[model samples]
Target: MAYKITDECISCGACEADCPVGAISAGDDKYVIDADTCIDCGACAGTCPVGAPVEA
Candidate 1:
């Protein structure tokens, strides 16, 4: 499954650089994960500071 950014995201942009697949991007309220591009590697979840990424 791909990872999703929850409301807990603080927009710190930490996960953005760590995403090897370039699946994450900044959204209006928070960072968002492109499910189609995500490789389900859990990289985003691992890189997030606030545990904002969840398996979707």
Candidate 2:
């Protein structure tokens, strides 16, 4: 499953920087993930300080 950024995100760039496949990007309110590009490696989840990234 792909990882989705929940509202818990603090709009930090940590997940974006840690996403190995470049699937994460900055959104208007938070970070968004490209499901198609997500490798489901949980890299974003691991790096997110707020634990906003969740499996979807």
Candidate topping lDDT = 1
lDDT for residue 37 in candidate 2, whole number 0-100: 98
TM-score to true structure, per model: 0.96, 0.96
**Candidate 1, superposed: residue stretches over 4 Å from native:** none
lDDT scores in order:
0.94, 0.93
Q: lDDT of candidate 1 vs native?
A: 0.94
lDDT for model 2 comes to: 0.93
Tens digit per residue, CA lDDT, model 1, 1-56: 78899999999999999999899999999999999999999988888889999998
Worst 10 residues of 2 by lDDT: 42-51
Runs of candidate 2 with Cα error greater than 4 angstroms are: none
Query: Taking the tens digit of each residue's C-alpha lDDT, what string does model 2 give over 1-56?
Result: 89999999999799999888899999999889999999999988888888999999
